[model samples]
Target: PDCEKNVKTLVDGFAAEGSPIVLVRHDSGDPESPLHPDRAGNAFKPALDGVEPALVVPKHVHSAFHGEVDLHAWLRREEIGEILVCGIQTNRCCETTARLGGDLGYDVGFVIDATHTFDEPAQNGRDALGADLLAQATATNLHGHFANVTTTAEVLGAIPAAG
Candidate 1:
């Protein structure tokens, strides 16, 4: 519920500081998929309606790094050593990006509250895993390992004020 709000807050805060905001959108190949390029569902959230990102990456895979645009190359070209990650499916795309970012030697901050996911049925026929549980697990797995798991407030506080 608060994910969109927090994401918007983070985006606004960073944008105010002239930070490069990279927006990643999943574009599915299947026309029937909601995430297909031609589908309205592929657009960014309403919260980000007026926000303009430095880069808009169209990705078919989970990790934004493997998108049509060379995310790493662009970051390097712009001399961006650190990145803040926040998006849908906290345990999927967000987690994958954080992990890959860490591997690529970038300082990654995973905005915990700015990302969210849904409950999923267990593969072994056990009870469905709750979204809260999945979120917590993602935090635990990334914190101090793949990325610095943090909140929107913390990220906002870290950004330097506009001169």
Candidate 2:
């Protein structure tokens, strides 16, 4: 989908800016689960090739901050006060991290356009909520409370490229 392309573009933009990009992968730890890092399904996408992350965080939980990895400590050690959170499952991991980051006292910039989600059937099973609709709802929940919801273009435009 466009998520792969969009995430690639954003990662490249950050690389151009000399910003350290952190790649977080979910490892369910269940050998039978395809989500395990040992499984091919959990492998990083080709778009992530050549993009070395400052840190590779393997998380089991939806929130990256809540994982065993000491992300908060690392951020504090680096004195990084703000974070641009973007990735798949707009209403899940992405939203969870944004909320937790804000609670951790970091200014969060949520790139709404750069994130994506899957559709879910309505509670009554009448219809499925489209991806776009889910994204909008995530933005609403994060904006002004957890983080500032923006786009990839806006974020790239805001940060100056590395010399």
Assess each prediction's global lDDT (C-alpha) against the native. 0.93, 0.88
Query: Where does the lowest 10-residue lDDT sum fall in candidate 2?
Result: 154-163
Worst 10 residues of 1 by lDDT: 154-163
The C-alpha stretches of model 2 lying farther than 4 A from their native spots are 123-127
lDDT of 1: 0.93
Candidate number achieving the greatest lDDT relative to the actual structure: 1
What TM-score, over all chains together, does every model reach?
0.96, 0.91
lDDT of 2 by residue, 35-138 (tens): 88779989877889999899988899999997778899999998899999878779999999999999999999999877878998988889899888989899
RMSD of each: 1.5, 1.9
Residue 60's lDDT within candidate 2 is 95
Regions of candidate 1 where Cα sits further than 4 Å from its true position: none
